[model samples]
Target chain A: MTNQQCGTSRIAGCQFTLHPMSDNFVDIILSALDEVDSTKVWKDTDDVTTCVRGKMVHVFDVTKAIFLHAAKTGEHVAMSGTFSIGCPGDNEADVYMAESDEPMNLEKSQTIDQQAGCKFSLYPLGREDYMDKIYEQIDLSKARGVEVSASHYMTRLDGDVKDIFNAIEESFVAVQEKVSHTTMTFTISANSPSNK
Target chain B: MTNQQCGTSRIAGCQFTLHPMSDNFVDIILSALDEVDSTKVWKDTDDVTTCVRGKMVHVFDVTKAIFLHAAKTGEHVAMSGTFSIGCPGDNEADVYMAESDEPMNLEKSQTIDQQAGCKFSLYPLGREDYMDKIYEQIDLSKARGVEVSASHYMTRLDGDVKDIFNAIEESFVAVQEKVSHTTMTFTISANSPSNK
Candidate 1:
């Protein structure tokens, strides 16, 4: 099913659609996190981390450097993929694409039981060795530690469009400053059944 | 041979490189502009346009859109082709796969002279079409405008990275408000030659 997998991938301005699967994205994320670790990963569930999910259509334009950063940082649990435009554009698009730097799994699930930190595992690499350093730079002690292994899929937002929009902005920051030369842009659509 | 034509051609998110010969993109754009005859296509020749004479990249995801739109509009003029992502690592990628919209080119010419009071001699579909009353209900403009036609193979930008960044932000207003899905987010990096 080439569905979208067959579409051409550009390094510059790009667009794609998003579907908010609230419980849906949360579920996948939960499952992936659970598989990684337990209590150690999620401290008091709520304390494990703050989680806010919503449905949104993100757009991003990754410059060569940003693309290179994305390529380098392939499986970041926190990499935002919102689609944004550069200077010239008819309008901004609602799409997001990103690479994670970690496996996005619970690091210490042994004592955590079923609680897994809120981390979305995503790595849709059709090519090999495209972004490895991104994974190599994961810091376990960080506030939001993203693992680079386990289950990786394009887990999207579910409920709050506003939250998703904000997250998209934050994601853009990482790609902008953390990642270099990459220009990523985003546009979030309204809440509609079609989005999920 | 194939490089000579981007008319019917389309590319996705992959950044493309170009160089100008005796026929720089300016020449091509001016020629295309004078043909439009309806609107002021070239607002500012010196500032608005960015020439892709040498190899450049398309960081936007509009290849398929550009191809399909141009094909449907019958306005595509350059040599057409598609690109693919090559594997870089085992699970990661070195090159960022592009799913960007096609680049826009309000064609220009070196030899042609602009008609009086006519900013654009020809335009596949333009800004006005984008803002039309009935058309606002839906947008056929993407298929008709930069995503598809315009042969200059470029657009213009007055500001540097900040200007472009601001433009991306400004463009996102619609997506964030009308579409109440997930909040839209943007990540930016300066799209420059030196960095790449």
Candidate 2:
């Protein structure tokens, strides 16, 4: 079922998993989780994924903080996340829907110096000119100083962690403006031994 | 660039990450890696994802084997994978492209008893009736005995691991016949505490 009209309940959420390549991965993961200020969003962690649901800004803010904190540990860390908006029947109660737009951990995460490589695919569901929109975002990411390349099933991005997240967040927001239901799936890797 | 013509090269690959929700995750991951016979594919392991490239059958076979083995250990395991075919400029030298179609570890993997919960999204790049194709696959999955439901940004499938993999593989193959370039991203969870 396609939802053509954007409903008043603009629900947004992200389901993500973080993997750290180290013997002390558990410590790294738990410590990173502790660093994030997730009080602003409805957060739940299951055996498979950690999901945060609420306002768009808060959702992105929490996911970004978790990844940044893990990456700052200097251990190879990788995160896969799916961000979605405008699902057909996703009218869940959101107590934090009216939360302030300010990101809780932005200042702390910004100070972390980590380089990240990312790949993402954006789905602008039911749009005819989907490729045009996809290419436009690729161009926009490049203009924002994130190295963009064409990869199998995804667009590759390489840059500082902050810049990469900014480019991703901006492209996702841009597509939401034109398409009623849009989703982006992305993988970000930092502190990898394979880095050139 | 969307490749309209399905080239003879027929490149296929899957990049995936496996997460075991246990303190001994590294052991589980390493032991599972040992179970998969990956000689028929071009396999590479980087910091974030392990990639298997070549013929579509072998690619899926290896990825499935790894996940099944880890799940059979009675540990909560979750895997995220992206499968893609017909990418532009993907003419890498596939040494085992001419390998036999039989999956290397099919018999062994079938013996494992594991239940899996999966969510997947498919993108027929540049296709006009993409939603129709996606809906068709959803109905097809339900018909094939996989419990299909709608979730945020993905279609959910809950069933035995074998049936779930079969539905996914069949859907991917079906899309290839119509769309020149097709990609599917899926997350599968086994032995998850959140399962009903």
Candidate 3:
């Protein structure tokens, strides 16, 4: 129903918004944001690196906590992981994938795994500028291969699937107004009927 | 300030939270975000390819916009040119940092101009991780370098400089509780008038 175009880089089985111009989004964004009750600042270099590399972002913390929440609320297995990437910060020249590890046992390229919920780029419109930074983190993770992951700064979060999705939505709307273009792909694991 | 650990990486002119316990970042985030709005999403793969080159996420709209932003806000003159790497939204695997035809122009590794403020990653506490990704993007800027950019999703933003240092305090708190482990780094840009 929106004027925004859909992205080819989609997250396998899910359909998410790209760049919607509807008025509804702005209000949702304003309402969605949370208040920072307290602030904790890192004092040293060691701490900064350690925190980001160590899955120190609040969102990431929330991601882990959500898994625990699932377990606490009595769900099946709770899966969790941490992603890390090393950055030198500036390149006089040259380009490289942040994470270049090839996934083993790949039957084909870009094949969606219904079971694992294989995803593709959900890159949206007008957001072409930020891709390098965001995906570099992904590259940082893939470089580590299945054994490791990168790019979860302040993104840790969890709750009911809807809640988790809300957080993601909130994260997007949170940044939406400022960025003119944004497209995303999401792949959600199908919930087993038994869980409910 | 709070008690956090060491970090995994470092880079040029890092900036991150100083105290582990600070204040609300959501408002700061909303205020700081730079919007790339009101543009068409590039859909045709061939058109997208021609706009940038090689493998990329392919958003011609954003790629063009950043160039415009640079041309509009930066000191350089003579605009009409193609991306060193390619256009935005090339559907490439990684975030790309297009070559700076005029790249900082340092015979040795000189620092990026930090005249513009509000670079959270540049903060001392957050530098290592920020630098890690930047360096990685630089190494992989060509084939994969496009993936590592401020435009990409992974990169932390240099949000509005207005009233932001205050928010840095909040970002830390959110992250501390979100991520499992944390550390930080901070530095005053060597080129700043304050330093000069």
Candidate 4:
């Protein structure tokens, strides 16, 4: 998966925002940030979102950690994130591409207990059979034990937070194997009043 | 657009989640919902998201109003939503297809003054030249006076809340003119601590 072979850089990254449904949202957000070990990825926080760039595994590892950490606080939390790989002309984060694939926060994240409901859409850019790829991933999602259903423009996933995240991460990584440039956008909600 | 021509339904809908960064999030969310005029659209709220289905114009009108109303309260607010049209096998919402084009809440939404920062990704599914459509819309977004810039997995947009929503709505409708199945995912944030 070299840049030259795909005409797009192999570096993967995610830009995500966390919203905690509490007046103390700032505390929840900051505290969650404090718990995640993001050293393996190149991270920057801006006014709108925080972006983590590096190996695909590391990017998912850190973003998943941030969300799980926030959810463990027992507050209603929602995370919106976009993950991309094989972005054309995206060389700015190439330095992090050399980082190892080992995830720094997976062990800690696995211990968090929470339920999540999510909806996601995947774009395998430039593929004529994009629907086939999307449907394939949907099938995989159901096999992973997350309750799956079709909704307008996206797929709904419901289950334990860990299982839900695993389904998302696996499908994302699996799609990248065949498509050089792929991007997915998703929103995960936990402990919402509507759920009660 | 007819279902027979596109092999998909013409019904447009949006599933959205609004997160207000305050302990009184429930009040903020409910208050904003109360202020919106959603009579033109079919709306249903569940544990994770609120789905509004109807004519495209009304769908955007309601979602944009809810976000703007929440932002007007001067509290930090973020909205995550997916706007989709031409979804195959989505006949459940076909009843909304008969709604009028008139937007029910446009005039009132215009009165809200707030700045917003947003990131969005558009998917014109099953098109080989999908990138062209996406880049064209990026150009359109710029022409609308919103600050546009490329980011990982999505494009960043910044401007007054109304202008931001307008750019998004226009671009979304523009693409639907050429492609039958299109879906867009976006995140809009206002009054964040990071911005301060």
- Please name the candidate that would achieve the greatest lDDT relative to the true structure: 4
lDDT by residue for model 2 (A76-129), tens:
678888888876556665567888899998999889878888877787765667
TM-score of each: 0.22, 0.80, 0.21, 0.91
Local error of candidate 3 at residue B116 (angstroms): 11
With a 3 Å backbone cut-off (N, CA, C), the pairs that clash in candidate 4 are: A22-B22, A23-B22, A23-B23
Give the CA lDDT, 0 to 100, for residue B98 in model 1: 34
Q: B111-173 in candidate 3: lDDT tens per residue?
A: 222222221221112222432333332222222111112311222223222122223333333
lDDT of 4 by residue, A14-128 (tens): 8788999888898998999999998888898877788898888898889989999999989999998878887766667577888877888988988887888987777777787
The positional error of residue B125 in candidate 2, measured at the CA in angstroms, is: 3.5
Q: What is the DockQ for all candidates, taken in turn?
A: 0.02, 0.29, 0.02, 0.40
Relative to the real complex, the DockQ score for model 1 comes to: 0.02
Q: Give the C-alpha lDDT of model 1.
A: 0.22
Stronger candidate by lDDT (2 vs 3):
2
Which model, 3 or 4, shows the larger DockQ?
A: 4
Candidate 1's displacement at residue B61, Å, is: 15
| Candidate 4 TM-score to native | 0.91
Estimate the lDDT of model 2.
0.75
Q: What are the fnat scores of the candidates, in the order listed?
A: 0.00, 0.16, 0.00, 0.41
Residue B168, model 4: Cα distance from true site in angstroms: 1.0
> Model 2 chain B, TM?
0.91
Clashes per candidate, residues 3 or more apart or on different chains: 157, 0, 139, 3
